[model samples]
Target: MKTNTTTVNGIDTQALLGAIEAIRNNPAEAQSKWHVTSHWKGGTRSETKVKSSQLGNQTIAKDFTIGIDEPLELCGTNQFANPQEYLMAALNACMIVGYTALTALEGIELEELRIETEGEIDIQGFLGLDPSVKPGYDHLRYTVHLKGDGTPEQFERIHRTVMATSPNYFNVANAVPLKSKLVLESPATV
Candidate 1:
């Protein structure tokens, strides 16, 4: 007798298993590529579009775009989420993905999983009121509330795995170098 495989939380379990098996067979197949582009629309607002990826022999393009803006008090129209908020969201979402994927990989069915993240930022630096203050979040906090069919020890192991393996979590915890160059554009002749 055979049981039909199904998707969980929008994740294809069979495909995931297949990918894991493929990775185990050939680690080079696990490397993935991603690309995104953003254009500044005015007044602290920008539109970022998910571009494309080279998966195997296919170039898949994403059709989704995200709008980013700050609150009115932060010199924005509050039309959308701020960049810092997006950072927190990315961290939480990455952890969620890790938890979901790892649980499925371990055959642990999850009844519920929730992730929340918070960070404290001092506006003095952003407003240029204090040169000594940092303009970014000095500290960030995140909480994961999970209720699953696993024991406490199992849950602890999952937490450790998520912390160790989550990409965004690792990124936020580690410092990454930024390379930027300013390119001035001339006004249009039209």
Candidate 2:
């Protein structure tokens, strides 16, 4: 039998169907692992690079990098996006992906989709101005403006799905465990 193919919101429905078939053929292939490495520059700046990730029994390579820094008021050169800004960007970007894919999978046609996010943080915690202040965003807010052919109920369903499945949203919404190990560096060899 021939497979039916269609495009929704610029995504190929057949491609998603193919992926579903692949995952069904070997469920283990659906599990993925991602890795990123970072190198600290100077004065609260760093560069993170992603080259490859493990996809089941295979590894895929790509060229991607991001430069991170704080604003001048935070004692940085303001050369690039700060870590906190990246955090917000991650959340918004992930939501965009999730929303678009989910909407397309549901056969919803979208005209426009925009997301804006902001976070509130008290610097006193990082600067040691007050011991009681937490060193992270106290609150974060996001507004998504969507224009599409789908009904409001469908949009609401998509919203709920995005919130539940978006990886970055899950990361920020819940307290995830972090394990850090400090490795003292030996003297660099010439």
Q: Which candidate is the best by lDDT?
A: 2
The residue-by-residue lDDT of candidate 2 on 1-190, one tens digit each, is 1133377877787797788899999999888898899999988899999999887789998899999999898899999999888998989999998888888888888889999998777889988889999988877999999998889999999999999989899999999999999999999999
Cα lDDT tens digits for candidate 1, 1-190? 1134456545678899898898899877767788888999998999999978866555887788999999998899999999999999999999999999877666667889998888889999888999999998878988899987778888899899999999899989999887899989998997
Residue runs of model 1 more than 4 Å from their true location after superposition: 1-10
C-alpha positional error of residue 73 in candidate 1 after TM-score superposition, expressed in Å:
0.9
Question: How well does candidate 1 match the true structure, expressed as C-alpha RMSD?
Answer: 2.5
